[model samples]
Target: MLSKRVFSLLCVAGIAVNGIGLFSGVMMIDGALYALIAKNMVLSGNYEFLTLHGFDWLDKPHFPFWCTALSYRIFGIHDFAYKLPAFIFWLIGALYTYLLARRLHGRNVARIAVLVYLSALHLLLCNSAVNAEPYLTGMIVAAIYHFYRTYREGTFSQLLFGALWAALAVMTKGIFVLIIVGSGFIVLWLVRKEWRQFLNYRWYAAVALVLVFILPELYCLYRQFDARPAVEVFGQTHVSGIRFFFWDSQFGRFFNSGPITGHGDPFFYLHTLLWAFLPWSPLLLFAVYFSFGKRRVAMGHPLLWGSFLITFLLFSASQFQLPHYLNALFPLVSIWTAQLLGNMGRLPANGTMHRIQWYSGMVIVILLCALIVLFHGSGWWVFGIITVGVGLAVLVLTRRVSPSNTFLVSYAIGLLIGIFYGGYLYPGLLTYQGGDRMARFINAHIAEEHYPDRLYVLDLEIENFMLGFRCEVPLQAIRSEKQWDAINDGSLLAIRPEALGEIPDRFEVEPVASFGAYRISRLTSKFFYYRTRDAQLGEFRLVRLKKR
Candidate 1:
């Protein structure tokens, strides 16, 4: 086991990396989109409705926006403020992971569980992106922990809090949280044959409390969509927000009948976990195998296995799935992985596990080093050298403290990769995100009194969000010819180069500036190679439109 001082230092290091992400620019696509929605809420002073580019938006639930808007109110609107609430919720996940592990196993496992959660590769990446998953992740684990407590102690307060957290989870995502949370307890009771526990009156009361707590979400959905049936969403009138929340958003996605859909791959998550749980995936595989294969029926905490397996299989079978969807299960996975690592001393295959971790850590470090070299060439030699020196120093120090503790080495390596990604790679990639760059350019020009009227975006969803969150003024969407015709003289317009042909011939469009653009989230080899990067980039033009 790690000493308290060492564990504290590692925890601080993990937190510092997450903080780096907090202050970084909001990412394109999801992050910026979510930021804009929350900013709209603050600006419009209408928390009941979610709007995007002056249209009624009805994709995600309102809980995350509510948290983000509250953060904006407290901290003022900016990237840091937008991401702060999600980061705090992720920390809540870490705390609950520790508490849940401690409850199930002990303090040592709890500490290890916290470390596993903080250093999980995708968790670190998602923290910077600031999506609904972060909020859902924290809430799901918290609800599960409290519900477990209620099961053990039968306290009304615990059950109430569990219901409250579950409600928040539902509000953050959808009704799927109930299945993820409830399945665990049901499995637990069935496995333990504690049939009487299912008959507990508090379970029914918890259901009522969850319903009562979620009324705010229901009311908001009702007023926004149900009451305003004339408003079009998903290109149709009479779209019900409440129905979407309970059915279309969750089950529709599962069955591929929602507005948003994806092709199902049975093994998508199975392959995704190999990287998503990086520097720890090998250990996790071993842990799961040992936990189930050797001690299946004897496993004390069936909640972890039940929740993870049921949710994993459900996501695997779902048509609409994304890698981040698995984040909610990480806390439970962490606890299980931590249990194996915490008992490393007593494990018969301790040497094999140690070697597996060491090799996996080396593989990650090598890949990250290769990426740095590939992206920056020899310019990053100094960085590479310094990283190597730090790695060697960590290995030496850990060896001296506990030669068998490969987890410390792996943890250190994960932190190093996180630092490099969060501090260097992510910010560099943002430069190619034309929307943010254009927004900044527009903000600068506005300060200089160039094209002083309010700017408009050409109805590009992702670009509009990227520019909307950063641009100082509200952006009107030019969705139709009428809206384009309504642009005031000397007002600037942000448009994609390919869409430039759509401008009326009567207007003289003079380009103010052009920005190189790429979807930083969807990277390709052509984009990564400096020699070919320009070819891969599209362009966004800031132009002044004048009537001919």
Candidate 2:
């Protein structure tokens, strides 16, 4: 085991390296969308309801936006400031994960759990994206930890705090927080045959507290959508925000019966897990195998398996799913995966688990090296050199260390890779984000021209929020030709280049600047060849229009 000083040093280094992501550029769609909403909330002084380009956006609850808006109020509106709250919450999640693991296993295993969580590849990636998952993950784990304490010690304070955290989790991502928190406790109760725990009135009081805490979200929904007759959402009339939040948003998505639907592939999450939790995926797989195959169900926390399985099955069966949706359960996985690694002394160096760990470490390093070569081979020589050097050092150190210390070395390597990705590769990729570039262009030109304080702006087909957020201005979306005609000559307009062809003859247009834009996650050789090599994917234009 590592000494306290060494563990503290490692943790500080890991966090400092991981924290490099705060300065990385805002991500596409979701990241930019949330930032924009928060920005508007601060700028417009309307904090109760959510909006997307001046339209009622009832897709998500207001808690996250409220936090972000509050952050902007204090930190003065930068990408780093916008993400600061979520990052802090992520740290809280690590702390809560440690507490929960300490209760389930022992101190050594709990430390391992914390290390595994801090170094998980995707968790750090999510840090840069600054989406709802960070908030949800933190609160859900906190709720679980406190609720577990309540069950173990039968304390009303623990129950109340757990319920409060659960309500915050729900505020972050709707009623799904209940499923994420409840499923594990249900399983734990079942395994322990604690039927009387459910019979306790304190539990019902906790539920009531949850409902009471979620009143703000409910009020916002009512004020925004349900207070009136009907509201338009996703081009549909008479949509109810409360109904969507209470039912359709969670269950409808799970059942694929909601308005927002997608094709469900049963094996989607099976493959996604391989990379999402790298350097630890194989260990987690082995833990599952040995736990079930070896009939070691008595080993580790039963809640881990129950929560992981329930979440895995729910998302896998859902028609609409994303890789990051599993983030909230990763803390549980870390504790469970750490159970085996914490007890590594029982197994020999030649054991199958050790071999898998060795192979997994090698695979993670090699894959990172290959990705760096393929995507950022030339420009990031410093990062490349450091990554290769650290990877080799980790491999060498793994051989020299005891089996227990070997996992630490592997996760350290993962943390280093995360640093390289977040600090170097992500910023490099952001250069290709056309909307951000266009927004910068607009900023400079708008400043140079010294346009009026309140310039009428129209957004067309550039449905991204990055432009408004980066330009530091409120923009109205032009929904029809009438709105297009309403734009004044001194006003500015942004449009997708494809929409330029549809411009009416009544207006004379001058394109001031154009920036190429595409989704980084969708990058492919064909896309690179056409979009980068041939410059054909799409462009965003800042155009000046005058009636002809």
Quote the positional error of residue 142 for candidate 2 in Å: 0.4
* Candidate 1 lDDT, 5-50, residue by residue in tens: 9889989989998778987899889899999999999999999999
Model 2 agreement with the true structure over 422-488: per-residue lDDT tens digits: 8777786677677788777766766678754432344434335787678755677766688766667
User: Can you list the residue pairs that collide in candidate 2?
Assistant: none
Q: What is the TM-score of each candidate against the true structure?
A: 0.96, 0.94
In angstroms, the error of model 1 at 157 is 0.3
Candidate 1 local lDDT, residue 70: 98
Deviation of model 1 at 197, angstroms? 2.9
The list of candidate 2 runs beyond 4 A from truth reads 294-298, 348-350, 377-379, 452-463, 526-537
